[model samples]
Target: MTLLPKNPSRLIREDDRDSAVERLREAYAEGHLTHEELDGRLGRALTARTRRELGAALASLPEERAGTTSTIATAAGRIRRRGAWRVPRSLKVASAFGRVYLDLSRAVIEYPVVDIELRLGTGRAKITVPRDAIVDVEDLRTGWKDTLYKTRRRSRPGGPKIRISGIMGFGRLKIRHARR
Candidate 1:
């Protein structure tokens, strides 16, 4: 999906409101809209009494795309890598689906270590990393709130390194650094 600008001047025009609504409907039908997400965006799109306000809401819609996948491993083979590592976006249907495969695999013996790197075009990112690893988070864009949560930790030599970049809208990035 193409990333829309965080602030698009075209969204405020009276003529574009209808098209924006249509796009929202399309996105909803595609199963990309969660109840909360639909309600939030719809509320903004509808409650905006002025064209400018409506435009602002429409312009803030999230967009994202998955890039490449790579594997990283150490010679000792004590550590295993998994999960999609990348920025988060509004549209995560694909990522959610991909998780099933990740869960089922016992360890493709051929590649015991795999670190998937997902390239995000735009949107929020939520990440999870192992506890034994060190985490480094960098917010490339300003004015957005990004959070990290440590869920669990194991006695290991190192931790995971997570990074977030290219945030173009108003949203939050919540990460679980370890397992509780």
Candidate 2:
């Protein structure tokens, strides 16, 4: 029996031309298509200036069956700070105070801050801080690739503070401090 519906839905919509190309590239890189097949399909996709052209190229690709869904749980509270805060996991902290805490054991973080504390656990997490924010990172677990970046010549003395802690497999923490 055919698992997919005889009349399957279109993968790429006419309005999603650019996105279709991007998705095609990702599929090709993931070995979903053979090199020869990818080369021909990629050529067609690149030359597709019109939405219809792009859609046709996308429709020609092989379909991928859906995998198991990923369950993501999250919790957030107020941190007496003036900035955008994002944490991709369940967390509990005194929001009344000017402190941000993240449990990167199962999620990635992307936000604007000056300080950062990273604790990764068996997964990859990425954080983006404001350029003027000072960064302080503490890696508690090893075997996880952790990277920290600072924007040159941008940061105020009293900027936001970031603190992260967890066990990570492959994670990244970035700090973009304010422009000087």
Candidate 3:
């Protein structure tokens, strides 16, 4: 039996939804959408399970965030991102049956806010953010275990903010602040 979903085509992947959300955020930032409009569309997008629904949620938005988002996917192997990698405004990281480790301690993050969407099927994801960075996991949805994170240090006044979302199915996510 394969780890891949039997009917993968019918379900909208979490990364696609994340891209749309990021686009919506960009539109909001550029003054294309009002707060009410963004909220409504975001609610719709998050609950949408099909391509049609997702498209409808993003119906009136402009084109994508000018390619500010990138995706890294692995169906059966590990995906690791670390060191001086240039972190985009929005990143979609997905793993179907393996581990994912993303370390932003030494990464070059240009944006004030970085969005990380993680979709794990049957493995763990370890994310290490800079000590001064702030993390927000309000949008993440777990299919099995809850994410493990403990805030032991205070974030800087203007440190970068990381927004994490997506689905974790039968997997665990451990997020921590990097040690200086």
* Residue pairs with backbone atoms closer than 3 Å in model 3 (clashes): none
Lowest summed lDDT over 10 consecutive residues: which window, candidate 3? 59-68
Query: In candidate 2, what are the lDDT values of residues 18-85, reduced to their tens digit?
Result: 55655666566556777786677778777665555566677756664343222233233322222222
Each candidate structure's TM-score, on Cα atoms with residue i matched to residue i, is 0.29, 0.34, 0.62
lDDT for each of the candidates?
A: 0.42, 0.44, 0.87
- Report how far residue 169 has shifted in candidate 3, in Å: 0.2
lDDT of 2 at 94: 22
Q: Residues 1-180, candidate 3, lDDT per residue (tens digit)? A: 737446769679999999778777767766789999999999999988888889998897766434679999989998998876668899999888999999999876768999999888999999999999999999999998899999756677777999999999998899999987
Badly placed stretches (over 4 Å) of model 3 are 1-66
In terms of lDDT, the best-performing candidate is 3
In TM-score terms, candidate 3 sits at 0.62
Q: Give the TM-score of candidate 1.
A: 0.29
Global CA lDDT computed for model 2: 0.44
What are the C-alpha RMSDs, in order, of all predicted structures?
Answer: 19.8, 14.6, 17.8
